[model samples]
Target: MTTHPAPAATEIAESTSDASLARTRRRSAEIEEQIAADPGRFRVLTGDRPTGNLHLGHYFGSLLNRVRLQRAGVETFVLIADYQVITDRDGVGPIRDRVLSLLADYLAVGIDPDAATIFTHSAVPALNQLMLPFLSLVTDAELRRNPTVKSELDATGERPMSGLMLTYPVHQSADILFCKANLVPVGKDQLPHLEQARVVARRFDERYGRPEGTDAPVFPQPEALLSDAASVLGTDGQKMSKSRGNTIELGMDADTTARVLKRAVTDADRHITYDPAARPEVSNLVLLTALASGRDPEAVAAEIGDGGGAALKRAATEAVNEMLAPIRARRAELAADPGYLLRVLRDGNARANAIAEATLGEVREAMHMAY
Candidate 1:
């Protein structure tokens, strides 16, 4: 006992931990520099509320790109915004089933289990927590001025919308900022929400957090990834949507998809053409046909031009049916064990929550708002 003093365990552990953190910091900075240079490796937080199953509109608009991105090395997170359903409605009656249906749809579309993490909104409380402090960053008038909220209110004829719906953008900011998400895959209408997230992240960082030089950007202002593809239309040639019950669900079987497409409106002129403005109905059909055939719409139009609207419709129907055949089979297989879908949700929730918790902690620490 009189010979020598022993080394402290705490000192050894701290030394090793500091070394590991330095290595991790250097690696992360390198990856960030690479993304800054290449651009497409941008991390994105994108999702659809699990109010219903995904359909052709979702496929053509965003999900299609997401599938391509996953294959192309983009880090993507697919969220089932189940919590937002209650923002408009009163309960969660159909949401449980809808969530499962959405899961089946995602799996069918080749959203690899390894590539994208899919989860429900409510499952990530850390994300929701961002809502509290985020609320302080914006004015009530700013939320009221959001054009998208106004459009939804107009479309649904819901006067005096819920506070949750009014501030849905804040929640969306939470969805992005919680993951520290920087690149958002968005349609034109969604530009405002991304704008709001940028504002809050910038404002909060300026007010209570640190700035990077001349000005600080706490959050990387997410850039909009735009799409010029024709939107998927429903049977009646209106926008394909779940609320209208006009959507051809991706999870539906081949027979069901074929049946849905068979009933969709086609051009009355019969000759195939690419005039979307003149014949949205037929043009939508032609567009779907082109995507399914892996040919340009101009090419599809040329091939089917001799045929009248009925023939064009029939050809469009057949092409869609052919493309959906395997997807339908895969969906049925997934549907057999519905629990597998729930498991995906659960696993995604765990991962998203962990990341979100870390983000929320940093946000709280920055603002000195931690309780």
Candidate 2:
């Protein structure tokens, strides 16, 4: 029999790229279809770094998806990424308090503790241990090429990146795989992190999963649950972030929300418009009002036409306050009893630890390191 030639490296690369693109397109369609159809049940993993209070950006970006998925019968895991805070920070000052505050915000936003497991990253020892083996599966070039890490470095303007910062994507892989989460709700900007996690999962399965006639993978390759929510902007017309102090906190009172919006930057034109390129500040406000009031941004702009910046700001402020009133009330009620918050964390940690321990045992067995 004549031997056949193996596929060239370039051909292999092209094939992989095409496959990835197809998967992405399919996932996008799935998200759109999910709106009309029940998602059945899937394990979803998503979280936040308890850097500060959760804001509108957090709400529209991922928190809303979390609540929806949890209610849709999906087993959701919300990790308070406490360990990720040190990636850029000089110290972990009052991280405990911050974690509690973040948890309170989750509760306030209707993240039912009984429905979704909310655990601190540091509380799960096996998750950290899972990182050690995963680091070897990734390369330096791959980590450096990650857009999220590059953006962090560029934004910080610092040299000699911290090892933890560089390997953050890998650590994130462990976080997702430790729970074997097959669905991760993320914005388009965060797709890279989720993709890297998929790479890690594939690598591990290829290296150790195939045994004789059996193919058993320990981790499920997660897909991105892309959201259709509009991009939320800070009061300064920039990306909404806690570091910039431009966020509208979820727990803000009515007056505080109005004062913040009143100072929001806008164009000097008397008429309202939705041209983001021409007037980002005004467009940002329109987008915020649209999200808060469940109206189209263009419609919102048309309704406020010839009303000037004052009217636009007033509408945005009213919409935000109206949406936040009940949330703020619930948050205040939850925040009053610190003991209740602690108990929730403790219960979540215990459940998460049990799942992580089981996963770590399987990982150890696959690597031939199990005793």
Candidate 3:
């Protein structure tokens, strides 16, 4: 029987050449090696949207890595992507409180504000201005072809896509390039956004930069620094997400954390094992326990052998609460001093504005727009 070709498959395969995740992974390893050898040579940019409280998934996924990089002597720039909250959501939802809460979370997790530049998106006007020139470097077709953008749009359902949503990747380029950050920490899903940033940097240098080989490029084509942490699953065996009600938020108290872990889904199998493929729910619990307790997952499962789900839940709850205790205590202390948090943001904003203005000036000179 005659049949039409699969358009979706074709698009994905064609897109894979430009955004090959495998290629990024190889490059990530090389970047990691170089960073290890000479950490001072790199500047990293990473951030989060202030949509809600940071969670355990975020802790293992990105926060811990940020601290590691900072301690390794790499310069870190942490952005509170306050503006991105509206990319898909309808309202900002107490954004001010959320930003403060996020700052507290970062501090409690060992993100020393003294060492890292922590700023909000709205605070840096020049950074946002870079979006105009960066947007011109890319095409509408390229933006629409972005798998991440398409997936996000699909998630928004029938809501009409906003101009901001359509140009999310471009804005992200501005985020990376405005600070002239040479490295970015990202998960696989975000590689596409990072790739778009690299493309913008290259195009801008080619079209408006100093004569070929006469001067350094206007911006560095930032490289991806992928995390080696295992994927963290929610208690329900699904991706840990706030909207899914599965996340163990960093703001949760010990008692609340225990209560949440207690109801986590586990299989009927009386024997506990760490086979993620065969028993995702039970394995997820064991994984959480292992991560928190700093033990291997298999060992954690062996310790709970024949104890069934009860033993697993108890182990996870205790381990998690113990690990989070100091963080929670520090968070409590920080919460009591709102003035300190404001000062941190204000200082970071001032520093960020200075950097963005400097970069924008370079861009203007490169394009002959400087008067």
Candidate 4:
């Protein structure tokens, strides 16, 4: 017979808890370092509402990075956020179609559905159930302060916001935590929501949820994957947005892309330089030129200085056209193959459902509602 010394139950419990905390800290540090420098971390979640097609801003800002993450071995979860669109408190359609359209773009741009899972917000019942307990963890005051909600409301001039609009971030928290996402790729502006997710996770553990043992945090506090690229501007030099009628869709035709670039705002001084503060318009053009052409922005600026802002705009336009030509072609090819896109979304949704089912079961059991 094998003999072993019996450690006290208290001693055993403390050892396990301490080890778990240490593991969380170590994993957090490692993942944060990677997000700060590298982008390959499993459990990264990012997505958009089906209000519109993606644009150039999304590509440089994150779409490409998402594709990179999926290929690099991280299991990516892309939320279609179909329900988020109805938050406008106005227009909506049969989400089933729009979701498929969005999936087309996702796949066309190399978002391998086989690699990344795409899910709809409305489809996951258990995930949505989280909003109930989740709401109890936070207050109305915090929700009112959500900058995204405030901005959307201000822009739309739609006051008396729908309950959906107000509670969207809480819903967002449920989305991330439901999957136990550890890393969320986001730009600077979206940090607040991630912070809220962490707070909700911490609150859940503190209130009723457990980490590994008695009374510990349930969700891992995710870190922001800060983006280096500035937000792409529309032709008017403001943020590129569909509402502003200035966005260039990722799948737009070459002729259309060129036309939009032609009208783009350039520096008034005529000559191009890298001084963004003194010459933001022309600098913006130079920046776009550099990104599109895969060359040094300053070098492109120097070459164009020989002519003027018009010259810089022309060069930028050409570079943008070239870069977009292939993407547009790929989008066209994918559009023709609608069946493939459908499969991608279907497969993604299944995977997301699986993840949600597991977490949702655990959550219900913890709260004594499993029955």
RMSD of each: 13.1, 4.4, 4.9, 9.0
Model 1 CA lDDT for position 311: 76
* TM-score of each predicted structure versus truth: 0.84, 0.90, 0.93, 0.85
Clashing residue pairs in candidate 4 (N, C-alpha, C atoms within 3 angstroms): 270-309
Q: What is the lDDT of residue 141 in candidate 4?
A: 61
lDDT of 1: 0.75
Q: What is the C-alpha lDDT profile of model 2 across 17-46, one tens digit per residue?
A: 657556766776776477447555478888
lDDT of 4 by residue, 1-371 (tens): 32212332122223225564455446556765665565554588899888777888877788888887787777788999987888764777766666776777787778876677788888787788889999887666667667778787787776588888889889999989999988887654676687778777776766666524445355777655655566567777888787898878887777787788778877557666887777777777788888888898789888887588668767877888788777777788887887877777667778778888888777766676777
- Every candidate's lDDT: 0.75, 0.85, 0.88, 0.75
In candidate 2, stretches whose alpha carbon ends up further than 4 angstroms from where it belongs are 1-23, 31-41, 155-158, 210-214
**lDDT score, candidate 3, position 297:** 95
lDDT of 2 at 168: 93
Candidate 3 error regions (>4 Å): 1-19, 156-159, 211-214
Worst 10 residues of 2 by lDDT: 3-12
Please give the TM-score that candidate 4 achieves against the real structure.
0.85
Give candidate 3's error at residue 59 in angstroms.
Answer: 0.3
Clashes, model 4: 1
Could you give candidate 3's per-residue lDDT for residues 105-191 as a string of tens digits? 999999999999999999999999999988777766677778867886778784669889899989998999999999999887777
CA displacement after TM-score superposition, residue 107 of candidate 1 (Å): 1.7
- Candidate 1 residue-wise lDDT, 1-371, digit = tens: 11111222122123225564455345445654665566465787898887778877887787777787677777888888888888888887787888888888888888987778887788888889889888887776667667767776887776788889889988998888888777776655676677678777766776677422324445666655545556777888887788898887777766777677677777557667977899888888888888877889988889887687777777777887788788888988998898888788888889998888877767766776667
